[model samples]
Target chain A: MGLTKSEIFSTEQNQLAQLLKALAHPARIAILQELMKSNTCICGDLVEELGLAQATISQHLKELKNAGLIQGTIEGVSVCYCINPSTWEMLEKETSGFFSSFKPAINCC
Target chain B: MGLTKSEIFSTEQNQLAQLLKALAHPARIAILQELMKSNTCICGDLVEELGLAQATISQHLKELKNAGLIQGTIEGVSVCYCINPSTWEMLEKETSGFFSSFKPAINCC
Candidate 1:
């Protein structure tokens, strides 16, 4: 029997996993940390901060944008990026919920 | 500028990213969910609960074990698995810290 991977899991499971996948890479994590450590939206500054090229940062930004984790907008000369607040909150809630879902009655270590 | 990916990022970022990678798959997420849903340590039950092949289940279990997310023990008739509580707590803390690290002053989206 052929069953699609996505078909079997609950929507919650799939969504959480997708978000995790988006954040799995070290480069992406570095990009995100740089954005967070900044007080204002970053505009072409990640390349300097992360030591990654502009093209590489843009590629990672694209993946984050696709996952709704980040958003970018064009300013006068540079494109600024920041964490999407609503999705950020959702990620927090869902991730916390997933971690808290397990209540162990007995420890079998 | 030659920069190794892991050499540039902080250890916190790298460890968190690695944990995320381990849980990034839908099958792995589902397997964890199934394990949490069960009351006691599960032994040879994931194949039935997850509707995945034994090989697939074992593979996913190995990944979880490698990440310190789950622990396994040999029972009389079967091997039992349960969540590794310490790593789980660390995951919860680190993930919460990552999400809370962003403090937005103005919406850029």
Candidate 2:
């Protein structure tokens, strides 16, 4: 079958994979970097900054929002976006834990 | 076009995305965790451990190896796999930088 058997994995494993999937695209990474660099809600500036069409940017933003990595608010006629701090922190901690698990052993492989 | 315009992003951004893509699956995460838990080269035991078919485990292992997250060598009649420490460290540093960029600003929506 061509389906992901998510039930077999631990919750942390699944959650990490979900977060990584959301960050797997270069466009999404760029968008997150832009938001972090701005340090404020960005509204209508991503298209010019990323050199991607508005539609593409919107799609990537939707994925990010769905992943809880970002949050958007309606400000006047435009939607302003910013990184979700809690989700970012969770991602950082979980990812760090995953990386930290692999301590290089002496004379291994 | 449906292709990723990777040229638009910085090298670090693209590299991070590539590494994340390799890790964007629960099975892959589980495999990495198992390898870390073993603390030694795993050979032919992942299928039993993960409950997935041999082919599926092999495919995930291939992706991990391609991403430089794991290394394998032929030992006797089987291939043994272990974590690639340098790539894991690089991944740790880069992902840490990415997450560290998002400082929660006061009164920012």
Candidate 3:
């Protein structure tokens, strides 16, 4: 909440951290996994699937949408949500780069 | 700070989220990047490299080490830090599976 000192880091590092922060919560992770498993936009099923209150699920969904990780649209009286393809691409690329770039050859105490 | 509701999520989901959370800070990401760039156990260079105070750097290092992403071993008086290969493998495997499992074929709003 205070100063993040994000300016000192490279754009890539900041972006990577932001993306990871967006996906850091267990509820969010669960929601994402459920969406992946469903393989389609979900409408009101998350509450049932997650066994959480509708309000709780909505807050989680809002966070995911705000992060651009997921997109939502209103259909009739319900909103449908699914993964945002572009952000998913960014997430995959950044994570792959971060993990792959590290070599475990450092011999330390 | 409050209850995490971890009981409702799978172990993998909880763990993946935990790992991501540990890496969700810019300072932490920067630390990891510096360590990777150095390609060896780093001792005291992080304070210089990151331009962050020693206490700040030490806290970030603690978070990473606590998550098992990095390990610190005391050498004489100073502690040496490096990536933990086993945990890195877990991180790589989990992220790989999470990203690759998506079909991306779902067409929706």
Query: Every prediction's TM-score for the first chain?
Result: 0.88, 0.94, 0.89
Candidate 2 on A1-109: residue-level lDDT in tens? 8789999988888989999999999999999888988976886799999989999899999999999999998998999899999999989999988888787987778
C-alpha displacement of A109 in model 2, angstroms? 1.4
TM-score of each: 0.92, 0.97, 0.94
Q: Give the winner by DockQ.
A: 2
Question: Which residue pairs in model 3 clash with each other?
Answer: none
For model 3, the docking class works out as medium
For model 2, give the TM-score of chain B: 0.94
CA displacement after TM-score superposition, residue B34 of candidate 1 (Å): 1.5
B45-109, model 2: which lDDT tens digit per residue? 99998889999899999999999999999999999899999999999999988888778987677
Ranking by lDDT: 2, 3, 1
Window of ten residues with lowest summed lDDT in model 1 chain B? B1-10
Q: Could you say which candidate leads in TM-score?
A: 2
Interface RMSD of 1: 1.6
Query: Where is model 2 more than 4 Å wrong at Cα?
Result: none
What share of the reference contacts is kept in model 2? 0.91
Which of the two candidates, 1 or 3, achieves a greater lDDT against the reference? Answer: 3
| Fnat (0 to 1) per candidate | 0.77, 0.91, 0.83
Clash counts for all predictions: 0, 0, 0
Interface RMSD of each: 1.6, 1.0, 1.3
